[model samples]
Target chain A: MIRIGIPRALLYYQYYPMWKTFFQELGAEVVLSSPTTQTMLSSGASRVVADTCLPVKVFCGHVLSLVKECDYIFIPAIRSVQRRVYNCAKFLGLPDMTKAVIPESPPILDIDIDVNKGKRVLYQAIYKLGRHFTWDPLKVRRASIAAWQAHLNYRELMSSHSLTPPQAIEKMLGSSEVEPKTHSSHSTSTQGTIAIIGHPYLLYDEHINHRLIHRLEQAGNKVLTPEMLTTEELESAIVKLVGRAYWTYEEEVVGAGGHYLESRIGGVIGIMAFGCGPDSLMMDVVRRQAARLNTTPFMSLTLEEHTAEAGVVTRLEAFLDMIYRRKRKQVEVCV
Target chain B: MKTYLGIDVGSVTTKFAVLDENNELVTNIYLPTQGKPIEMVQQGLKQIKQQLSNGADICGVATTGSARYLAGVIVGADLVKNEITSQAVAALQYIPQVQTVIEIGGQDSKIIIIRDGIVTDFGMNTVCAAGTGSFLDHQALRLNMNIEELSRRALDSQTPVRIAGRCTVFAESDMVHKQQMGHRTEDILYGLCQALVRNYLNNVGMGKDIQPPIVFQGGVAFNQAIVKALREELNNEIIVPPHHEVMGAIGAALLVHEEMVNSQNGSKFKGFEVSEIKYHTSSFECKACPNLCEIAQLSINGQVLAQWGGRCDLWERSQSR
Candidate 1:
């Protein structure tokens, strides 16, 4: 069986279920690069230019790791996941960037996921991807349907439950008797909730964000994230904006940020990667909205490869304390 | 009289401040850390005890700065806060109407923006020390002059030369080149100051909505040349509050006062007796995986006190601290 390597960065959290199911249906063994590490970050940082965001640098390292293991490495050139919205420029240029940086890597299988050129273009891209493994078009169609269903189910599972993408993926992949990994939830805790708005790559990548969700939970505050909301809710939260945001993934973060502003949550925290253009724009929008409402406390953390854990922890603890003190002051005013 | 003590164990200095129950500064001390934070803190503790009158009630204690965690466990702080929050609180205490705080320490510089008496936004310098006090200190050393002399000499310059200060490495070479180009030392000093201010505004203070009534604190506030450059760059009068060098300790003290008043708890202060406790810190490389994380272990004599700095907390959990 042909081994298909997938770098565990960027679109890995978004389309892993679909790709894994599709390749497994076609009898190809799927190999995922391990969770990010300091070594990987250093290697990635050394290879790429200084200004590349932490996630992309991490992506380079993951690709480099998978090169020696698998026959073919997968790093999709994702332009758009939905109509009228484009991914970051880096995402669109990912395939070419990989080739330029790695140079000695195994052959990369590229897929165009843009819906702007219509649905048929997407199908054609998938068909081209399937041709590498088998010559049957009918088999590819069936595999595509299964992949699509797996993606929908995965989305449903994550939205309905407060599961990080990695945890949800694990739940989907595990056998019949195995249970979903227990996320340290705040549902039982009486403390005030904090809504975190960020991409799945930052939220689920524990190494990058320093297990921020778990840190919040341990600080006696409930945590809410963008991944916890369904598509319908996400859309409604974003409808207040004049039009769809230019960046696709950031629209979801802004929408969730909007929702959290009107929510009973004590604060709003945004974890953005350092030097992310789309996030900076989206975060500015969220900051303006939060400023206008002036109810929920807002904190924005820019995480890079060298962002110290102590610094993050200190800020988080201080923010939590500020919220707690503000809540108490509010109670005092009421009484 | 009741007292609240705050200790700020910074990268380059250790500071201690005691505040009365009425939120008045009683006494404060500043000493060089010199790569021995624990000893400096202990010496500071001993000095503070001697200064205070007998029967002064110690209400609460707080720790702030980079080494706050270790200090908290050592001195048994009632509260531990980030330097940003501590400094903001201290700034607000000094200048109630202050909207902006520009703090430059030894190795770090931070900008804090306040709105209606709350820290709305803040930014810290990342990957660069050009905008901080140590950068100037290093330059002063290279010029065979003390930091205070550098500041005084800089004030004598009529026409200041511009030194590139985007980075420490770049700024040093640029300074050397300017020296070879027949520029006066005082002129170059002012140029260095201006360069640092420019780098700070462009980097740490970028895109920040900097309002007036700005209060500049931290160790670098003592450098009049940098302050002059900052005032000229912003075109506003910069107020350097009294006790600016030890504002972090003052802030931590003020925070402890508030926390004690609200929580109404007895202080966990290890007392001035902490000076007797011999603290030792050592590091070992964890051979887990390819990433060899250097885990630091703090011990009190033969007993392991705390373990920190590993990606995984397997060793952190190994010790109670």
Candidate 2:
């Protein structure tokens, strides 16, 4: 059986289960790097120069984690699904960057998922992988189709239930879900709810945000994110809210924010990194729309090396307090 | 007496400071770049112009940061310095005896070790998000707290939870686990502060002899919790000036002062009206070599001002003149 390694970064949050299922069906063992860590980050940091972005550095760390353990490491180059909607330059050059950074040349399975460039679709990308592994095209096609169907069904189920991709995979697989279950009592009624809008890379990555999600949960506030909504719902929400086309990820966030806004969510939180070209432009549009929806308080947080937690916490507390007071006044009026 | 203006257009924030003949700060503004640095600079200039004292003569201007070239063009600056020099100068001004300067911004962090008022060694962590101000900001949002309160909450903590500070993923999982284990929010927050300090010390502060008289500046310096954390971690008292956040701009302004006073040369400051000028950028991937360098060129009114991102100096020299 051919053994493959997948570093746990980038699209790993979205596509890990699908990749794992496909490889398993094909009788291949997939070795994944452990959840991102400092050791991994340091290893990657040492390997690359300082100018690379945080995501790329983390990706490099993941790649380094898999270098010695697996026969071949899979690093896909995804350009764009459509024209004018391209992935970040980092994603497009990931494979080449990895090869350049890693001194010991490990065999990389370079798969291009550039639908806009007329390269490969989801089925074709997997089918090509199947061909690379085995000469039997019929078997490869059958297995690929089955795997693709399973992935699609899985995504559909997740969308239907408004579950995150990981949550959906766990619900289907019934095992191997690493996330700890939240107890009902721990879900204390939040004084206010805040929507954290950002790409999964920035949202889920703890080092990037310094464990922001957990902190929010600990603060006893409901933290809503884009992953909790379906792509269609998110897209529709973005249209309803912004009335403008946005980058795919930004659209999901904006759409989710729209839903939150309509739900009269207490506060809106927009989280983004410094030097993020796309977010820099998209966030302004989101903020303006959020401002018009005055029923809910809104704050846009831009993170950079000089970001101070004190100021952020103050803003959040004030936002929550304002919501609490508003809710209290509304109750008083009703009474 | 002529006044000089210095603008530091960082990725996350744009800073502007005006200096008199003595290079003292007459006025300063620290504004969010919001990704439209050109617009921000223009806005900042307009605001500064309104605030300028009567009879203040505008002489020369300087621009610095990742978008220095563009900012320079917008402000019609005479000097453009990297963050290192600007920061160094700023640190020197606040504490002339300062041996080390730790500047952490929203997106990146740096450690500058100074020797006898000269920068001898420096390390920058631009690639990682672990030790950045933005990371803390994200965490603050997660805590549903304003950033200003983080330091107080951290100070109030009795027990600091042990969070994995190395990577964002592990830190998150660790935080979740700690929360499940019933750790106090304050404790968890303090633990995060420690974790961040640890990551910074391990990554950027690695292998460097950090001497005393350390000046900590940048927007993150405003976080007292981090300042305390750094003090505890380093086992040394850290100095934070009154204008810690706007040090870069202040430093740039001081440099302009030094240049003018030392050389006896006149200032080259274009007036505030230069902010109205239009600037445009165009990028083309150079296939001349396998490097496939995507050279991005910045121009004003069809005249090329600066070009960067090329691997070699091929395009740089051609655009220099």
- Please, what are the lDDT tens digits per residue for candidate 2 over residues A1-335? 67799887877766777777777777788888776665676777688767766667778888988888988888888776555565677788888888988967479888777766454465577678877667777777767667678778776776567565556767876645434433334456665667777677667765556456655666687777777776677778767766655364666456766777667676677777676777767776666666575566555565543444433443444345445545665787799
DockQ of 1: 0.39
Which stretches of candidate 2 lie above 4 Å from their native place?
A1-335, B301-303, B317-319
TM-score of chain B of each: 0.96, 0.92
Q: Highest DockQ: give the candidate number.
A: 1
Tell me each candidate's RMSD, in Å, in order. Answer: 3.1, 25.3
Fnat of the models, one by one?
0.24, 0.00
Worst 10 residues of 2 chain A by lDDT: A177-186
Docking class of 1: acceptable
Off by over 4 Å in 1: A46-52, A67-69, A96-107, A175-190, A232-242, A262-264, A291-293, B173-184, B261-264, B288-290, B318-321
Q: Give each model's whole-structure lDDT.
A: 0.86, 0.74
Model 1 C-alpha lDDT per residue in residues A1-335, reported as the tens digit of each score: 89999988888888899999999888899988888877887888889987889999999988888888998988789888877887888999998899999998899899888899998899999999999888999999999999999999988888888876777888898732122223534446557888889897898787889878777876777777787788777777777853566778754578899888898788999889989988888888888888788788888888987788987887787787667766776687799
Model 2, span B12-36: residue lDDT tens:
8999888888767788999999999
